[model samples]
Target chain A: MPISPPFRMEAMNNQSSEIIYTYAGPRTASDTGPFVKTRLMIREFIDARELIIRLFIRNFSSKYRQSVLGIVWAFIIPIITVGMFMVMGNAGVINVQGLKAPYAVYAIIGTTFFNLFTAGLTACTGSIVQAGSMIVKINFPRIALVFSSSLMGIVDTAVRLILIAAAFIVYRTAPHPVGVLIGFLSLIPLFILTLGLGLFFSLVAAILRDLINIIPFATMGLMLLTPVLYPIDNSSALGVVTQYNPLHYLINFPRDMVLYGSSELTTGYIVSAIISCIVLIAGWQFFYMAQTKIAERV
Target chain B: MADSVITVDGVSKKFSKSVRHMMLYGTLDLTAGSFGIPLARNRLRRGEFWALRDINFEIKRGEAVGLIGANGAGKSTMLKLLNGIYMPDLGKISIRGRIGALIEVGAGFHPMLSGRENIYINGSILGMKTAEITRQLDSIIDFAGIEEFIDSPVRHYSSGMYVRLGFAIIAHCRPEILLIDEVLAVGDARFRRKCLDHLKQLKENGVTFVIVSHNMQTIDGIATKGIFFDHGSLRYCGTPGEAISHYEMKMLGNDAPFPETLIEGSTKPGSLRLVKYFKDYGTHDIRFEDVRITNAQGEPSESFASFDAATLKVTVASPSETKTRMYCSFINEDMTVCMGAYMDISLKTGIQTIKIKFDPIQLTTGRYMVSLRLYDEYLTNPYANGHFGYFSVMKGGCVETPGTNTPYCWRTPEVTIA
Candidate 1:
């Protein structure tokens, strides 16, 4: 049989305009350069949000399915870890300066918050490798996978915070309203920082399988460097380290707000939020740049 | 004309096996080598290999194309690039419409989720909006034919049912461009046929398709054009028939010769006569008897059609007393058995003759194989036997291809009528 004639050929004359307008559904281009490019980026952001929500819900539901105590595992791990640390503190195995509160309460709050940060980071970092098959088969924003895993950590954190509130009520200790508000506000910056780190880690893990083994050790070290178990006072070497740690402000902001009724916003919190924003933006840019290589690598 | 839907321009994707295995830390260590001067020195040691080199093609709207290749031939890599699952290392791919892919169908399906819930989840993963899936839900369930079990967890589904549901959802996607990779061969015959028919219907509705398959017959039935890949490069791209013939030529070079006889005849009552037969008397090829049939009045006939009344007669010479059964059968060219007749009788010493007349031969219009079997029928069991005698029936002649339709032409003002 004779082969059919070749299909119509159309040369792309205005390539830049096509790329910008096509992303936003055939928009009329009135300006050139960065302004038009930003419009295309905004469209990509909207598309990414839609994909993230679905993946987040799917990942969250599948993890807890068929368990008798469905989402309670999220709360149970933090409670148990904090309880073990509280026992060490009460037995005079560790020392805390400048605090009269029960050692169990203080340890639970610190460990619970720090665990949320590290667990969220590790899970998010491994998301790309875990969903390797999906990455190779489906077409979507690759960063959605990393972000969804980080968001699932937020769900776990919400559960742990509820347990902390219950402990405070049981002990007949009232948390100041300002402290509770600060605790809630601190989560936003923590999530942003974790997401950025997760995307960077996920891309690295997808390309180099060895990163899967290394992430746990890195997160453990980060936890130790932060004051999750001990109190941070104004006049000590460990306190200076805690004050300097980027994640330290995130953990401490919530504890300071809920445990002490102080509403003073520190320069540390301001610096941490700025660092979180920079990381989140840079992390997204690096992930998108590396994602094209992931389909081949994975 | 400027109406092309896809344009792939000088695209090349190179993949190195060793570089893929290299750790991320290795790249960092190499780059971190004493800042500027050492970085230039370390770069000279890296290696590069190419998988796809300078490939180019264009697909217009409403075209159905097939991608054919051997196991490692970069056909899958090409599909991944088109779907935006992978980017080309060099050059560009531009596609102008909504694209849906069935590359590893059910890739994101969760076993714990019910079929209904998974439909939404899997649909979103394939780039469908929730509202779009809701609109297509009824059609998907109808096509899958799993409405009764839609609420059941997918873990309970058989592998076939899982694939059926996956294909059905993809079919309902209403994409402007669809990419399918060997997914049609996953289900049972009925579902496979259904998927092919649905794909054909979609092609007619102006949806462009790119199908990848090793099955030549399936590709021939659907693809208007085909591209063959050999060792990560385009070896041939043209008409489907030419592409399939090219693939078959390569496959035949690797296969052994066809067997002389696939089946041995049964031994029973009212069977064909055997003059001589041997199963292992030849080297590389088996040898058989010069078998023929005669009328009851003892006359020879060269041919017997199913419409003719005939008698079966046999004459055989044995070295000693033998107890065996005789068998006769008819089979089609494709090796489908049509009908059979057999007889068992006792023979004693040398030159034994057997004759049996059948009322009529019942068969369809096709070529068939006639086989006879002889086996020992005594000593322990009276029904055990050996086999012999094989021939063919060229009944009702061969089938012819259907005639093609001639295009009608009319006189135009641009052309002068003679």
Candidate 2:
């Protein structure tokens, strides 16, 4: 191995280099600069990758082990949700205009993609609280819990994509091949934004239990405001609300890409992506700072 | 300085008095922290109090330190802080090398998962790599002795099986520093013995340990050093023997040093008490001042080898010339009187001393209590009686007996061919 600095730490063989952890009174900044602290956090997270995978497998298998439906629940919920919206649209209880795709295809795509954000955020938010005893008794990267739960959400969303594919087969509709690829790419920003909010909400929800009960309702409300079930009429009041909602651009960009081959809201999508990145970075820093006391409070 | 593996400076930690306050303050802190405003951590806010206050200690590499304290005396808090679960509100703690804490075994086990799978999860949570766990899988299963049930769901396993599997995984993790809290006696006595033997082997291999236990025997048997915490303060830290004594003294209301006497019950002048002494009842007229047990070499000691000569010395202070019956009995730890002796003794106005010697004290390996009594001329209505002290007989004997080692010989027998 090449020689390195005196302060650098090697995991198992640190005979030559020293690693010291000094915990003192609360301070606004770590003894090391933010840049070094961020590096160390990232390194610690990387070192715990195995634990994250194991946790993910543990939760995934246990969640379905006792149920007869098992993995089918992943697609069942989305299908039932889309079926409800299609029924309402047929009855004219919900009206749509200027939509290129069939109502079934449009509703399926919207519900499944929006479900990614809602389900991912809800799972991530509950991860820390669900592992309360483990957090108090063991010392590991707390972010591993959030990451593993988010992985579960991702895998669950992947399963729902099979449902979306079956919907297109039934409707005899073909999505633009390039737009579909870009649409999958667009889910990255949405995932990042969900993770950022999940990190922040998980931290706060552990301290205030009301947030745990409040998140599902809040996500449902957000879905209505974001036009996930219907097309946005620019003159309607809900359309005005969608204009200010970041999720509006995040969800519509990918759905529009898969449907209409391209989106005219590129500027709004870029701005929302930037906002997602910022939220992720800020949420990560806050989680890192607040994790020290989580064991005690929990 | 580099050899010191763990250093806890003047560290302190605080907790809120109420859950409502905790939620409110947590929300406030998060909100304020987003604005880059730090909380007043050095001082206490409303509904906050220190759990551990300004504690300091250092453990050199390979030193096993035992923490002894009463319930709620901050021993667990100190362990949590050492494990980096909680940050200090004041001062600092610096530690080198990896730490593995056995605060609660099977902490992350999923009920629906099999033991084989939960081992990976639990091991990874303990900072072990997947390859390391795979390498140690068979050994972990063998050590836990649950191979037949390894593939079964953990929820179906008994609590003992669960703990054994958990401990087996952590024991193989090979942490540089191990911190344990009252989890030593996890399963049956046999399993406890196995765990203790494993800990001893680890200590021999230079694994640093910090253990918190209320079982003094466990601490004395394993730890090189002992720390005593009382009411959130470090009362003493020294060799395990001395720290145990200090802790015992404190726990017994600080009335246990040698030569310190306590008088129990009312010693009326002419009451013909027809019953035994309740707890060291004594009349001040004729009393035993000092009592001690000495070894064969005539040096005061509380422990002696079996078949070794021992001495018992008693100092008496009398008001006037009086005659009393001196009675002494050797009682085993189970309160059974193994031997007794009595003699008529004369005492002067001032102080008098008596010495009794036993050649080859025929006691087996165990602790024994000494009871001394001074009865009046009638050999009843005792002037004073006290359970003065205790001593122990260690190894070095031909045979082990319940009460005493009796001198005997065995005849050799010749076997005939069948």
For candidate 1, the per-residue lDDT at B20 reads 42
TM-score of each: 0.74, 0.78
Worst 10 residues of 2 chain A by lDDT: A1-10
Minimal lDDT window, size 10, model 2 chain B: B409-418
lDDT of 1 by residue, B296-371 (tens): 3445553454444444444555556655655555555455555565555666555545555544444433333444
Q: After superposition, how far is residue A210 of candidate 1 from its true place, in Å?
A: 2.9
TM-score of chain A in every predicted structure: 0.84, 0.90
Residue B12 CA error for candidate 2 (Å)? 0.7
Best by lDDT: 2
Model 2, residue pairs in steric clash? none
Best by DockQ: 2
- Residue B110 displacement in candidate 1 (angstroms): 0.7
What candidate 1 gets wrong by more than 4 Å, as runs, is: A1-32, A35-41, A233-236, A263-265, B18-49, B254-418
